[model samples]
Target: MSYEGSFRVWRGDDDAGGLVDYQVEVNDGEVVLDVIHRLQATQAPDLAVRWNCKAGKCGSCSAEVNGRPRLLCMTRMSTFSPDEVVTVTPLRTFPVLRDLVTDVSFNYEKAREIPAFEPPKGVAPGDYRMAQVDVGRSQEFRKCIECFLCQDVCHVIRDHEQNKPAFAGPRFFIRIAELDMHPLDTREGRAEAAQDEHGLGLCNITKCCTEVCPEGIKITDNGIIPMKERVVDRKYDPLVWLGSKIFRRQT
Candidate 1:
């Protein structure tokens, strides 16, 4: 069965915008993206929304549904009552390019700031090997689709625009955690970079990034917290500090 749904969609560009109400037809098993598509087809031909592979893996459809970051294609319409005025808005953390689409280039800049995976010097591409446990650990982080919902929800950049320059946010934190955990990776001082450079200290363990993840990746527990612990241990532990000094001297 289908019903008429009330949707309040934000429309306009960076300089001006407001939520424009629309009464649209909602169908069974349909998602918010579908309704937005309906709006594009019926009423608002100029409505701007970014989406691809509506199956939820592409992460292109990132937006705020009633102020919560979410992939519009994955948010089922059934979650809301028929009469509820579902509000769809652009991700607030980023600048609005237009209706329901924000300039997410901030995430790309953060991605570029992260160092790439460096394999051991002697290990050839085919010869590199890792234990099952290590492979499993890395695989979990590889599941990130780069949705930026985590970044959008992160308060460091969300609330304080000034913090954007210093903070790489949770998405890159997990990336650093992944590389730091790599058994064959030769890069050193990753934890230091995370803390001193990427603004890891600003996190405060809020876990807001983990809450909105569509993939259910334990971003806070599995990635950020462990990295924080490593940072603490490396900075404060006497033995680790001594070992680092000795290693540097020997090298």
Candidate 2:
């Protein structure tokens, strides 16, 4: 049976906007993005939907499907009843550029703030060895495609817009944690960076960021929690304090 539905896509430039409904026909196994293309070709020539590598690898084509942040190409039309109207909107966390497009410059700016990796002296180019198990720990974070779905779903930036300035969001926390856990990383001040106003403390461990992560990065459990632990140990661990005092006297 052929399925047909109406998609009420958000349309317009930065100056104005409104929902414009487009009727589309679909076959079994077709995705919402496929239907969107049909609408663009036939109904609305000026419609805009950002996308690349429709196979869900590029992480573009990310938008709020029925108010949920998801990759449209990965979302099948079968999930909803044929009679239902699917509403596609831009990610709510950032300023919209135009219909279904948002200016994600904020994330780029945050990325620039993170310190680059500075490995220890003993770690040679190819000689920086790490156990496979230890290497596996940070590998999950490496799968991130920069979709920003986690950022879109985070209440720290969504519901509480005021926190955006000081909150680095979950993605960067994962980066920090990954580098901090790197065996060769001899850089100091990670604990301070994680505990800074725009760091781990901003994450309330709501796990919303984890839930929206397409790569399945355990943001709260692996990244944020461990970072918090490191911060606590640095500030309050008795042994660290004692060792610091003893080392200072010896020097």
lDDT of 1: 0.92
Model 1: per-residue lDDT, tens digit, 172-246? Answer: 999999999888889989999999999999998889989998989899999999999889867868887788777
Which portions of model 2 miss their true places by more than 4 Å? Answer: 122-124, 236-251
The RMSD of every model to the true structure, in order and in angstroms, is: 2.2, 2.8
Cα displacement (angstroms), candidate 1, residue 186, comes to: 0.5
TM-score of each candidate? 0.95, 0.92
Clashes of each: 0, 0
lDDT at 117 for candidate 1?
91
Runs off by more than 4 Å, candidate 1: 243-251
Give the whole-model CA lDDT for all candidates, comma-separated.
Answer: 0.92, 0.85
